[model samples]
Target: MNAGALVLVVVQVAVMVVLSPLLVGVMRQVRARMEGRAGAGVLQPWRDLRKLLGKETLQADGTSWVMAAGPVVLLGSSALVCALVPLVGTTTFPLVPDDLFVVVSVLLLGTVALALVGLDAGSAFGGMGSSRHMTIAALVEPTVLVSVYALSIPVGSSALSAIVEARIADPASIASPVSLLALVALSVAVLAETGRMPVDNPSTHLELTMIHEAMVLESSGRDLAWLELGSWLRLGALLGLVGSLLVPWGIAGDVTVPALAVGVLALALKLGVIGAGLAAGEVFLAKLRLFRVPELLAGSFVLAFLAVTASYLVVQG
Candidate 1:
């Protein structure tokens, strides 16, 4: 990659790394306020990460190397995908990494890696969480894929940069019913996939109410720090992905400094909006029964299918 491209990549990762925890904190604070209570400041997640890092490591007995390596691998995979997500730049030669297939693969890799960590822990709670997580993941993945595919139909390419470029070139495509339905499906997938409320509660530790929390019950110290930080980064990356695909505004183009700056600003604005919506959902909605989670994702899959069908009809018309 050219030095400019390398620099842009670094900037993209750095921006997400610095802002990811802040987004989580914002969501929590917003939820607290909506529930009529005082909440931690938006810097709470940063403070929590620092606390985790300074604490000592505590590895579980009988756990495999996969457990020990899982947190770093999960975080590393998330960071890798963030670099190619087109969060800042639209496209750069020698490193125009915007393949939709790669994005989905990396995301699944992170999910599976975390699942391995949970299963390797040898704890009953961990095993239970891993199984539940995988079940929902299986249902959510297809919905996510179909939603993006529906969005990319107009562009004739699954490359995120190409899709964004096409959308920018014809902004009206954003308002199509197909796009709207696909986005709705994607919203459900994001909430379920990210372990947000009404799917799984990020803040809850109740064993009966845990899906993601159960998986991480065995990690402590820096391992937990990496996992926690990675969760934040994952949320940020997903939000950025949605913004690039659906919002597609102010993204850097032509590698200009001013354009990149605007892209960063726009990216933050989009994440803020997503975080607020998440907070509101958490406050207003209750977590579903484990069996009912499938119904939620299944509904998303149907919407995604309709989105694809509608896109073909609309595009043809």
Candidate 2:
């Protein structure tokens, strides 16, 4: 990578790491306000992370190295996704083109890592959470792939940056039925992938309803810190993606100082708006039953499939 690309990647990753916790805080605050409670200030997640890092991680007997390695792997994977996705700018390494399949594969690595962590915990709750998680993943992943594939069809390439650039270059495309359908489907997939409401409530700890929380019940201190931060970062990055696709403006086309500044400001604004809106929407939503979750995901897949067919028809017409 050239110096410009390298600098852009570093900035994107740093921005993501710093803003992710705040995004989570904003979401929580929004939810709290909507629920008529005085929320902890938006800095609560950062405060929680500081406290967690200072504490020592405790390991239970019979737990293997995964208990130690899993969080690190998950965090590392999240960071990698931050680097690969076009959050700040479209400039990327020649060797790392931000291909759609590659990005999805990297995300799956974290998903599998988290699932293994849950299973390695050797607790019944952990096992149950992992099972539910995998079931959701099986349904959600295909929707993500197919939805993006529909988007990629218009660009004739799978690099996410290229797709974003194409939409920016042709803003009218963003309003097309194909784009609308694919984006909606992709948004639903993101909610499921990120453990948001109506799929798995992030704030819930009820054993019967827990999917993400159950996996980390055995982790504490720095281990838990990594898990939380990793998940937050992933959610932020994906939100940025959805924001960029929906409104592909202000993302730097060239890695110059002014453009980069605009990119950062735009990214922050987009994330905050989306986070607050998502939190508000969730307040009125109910979590679907475990069996119904698949039906919802399947419905998204059909939208994605229709989008792909529409895209091909548009091209051939």
lDDT scores of the candidates, listed in order: 0.86, 0.92
Candidate RMSDs in order: 1.5, 1.1
Per-residue error for 125 in candidate 2, Å, reads 0.4
Q: After superposing candidate 1, which stretches have Cα over 4 Å from the reference?
A: 92-96
What TM-score fits each model?
A: 0.96, 0.98
Residue lDDT tens for model 2, 73-165? 999999989988899999988887799888888889999889888989699998999999989988988998999999999798999999999
Can you give the lDDT of residue 73 in candidate 2?
A: 92
- Cα error of candidate 1 at position 108, Å: 0.7
| Model 2: pairs clashing at backbone N, Cα or C within 3 Å | none
Which predicted model would earn the best TM-score? 2
lDDT of 2 at 13: 94
lDDT tens digits, residue span 1-317, model 1: 47777778889999999989999989989988987889989999999999999999987788878877999988988897888788887665454556878888888899999999889978889999999999998999999999989988888888877888887888888888988899889989988888997899888868877899999999999999998888888889988888776888798876778988898899999999988887886787888999999998999999999999998888533
The best candidate in terms of lDDT: 2
How far in Å is the alpha carbon of 223 misplaced in model 2?
Answer: 0.4
Evaluated at residue 127, the lDDT of candidate 2 is 90
Which residue pairs collide in model 1, if any? none
What lDDT would candidate 2 get against the real structure? 0.92
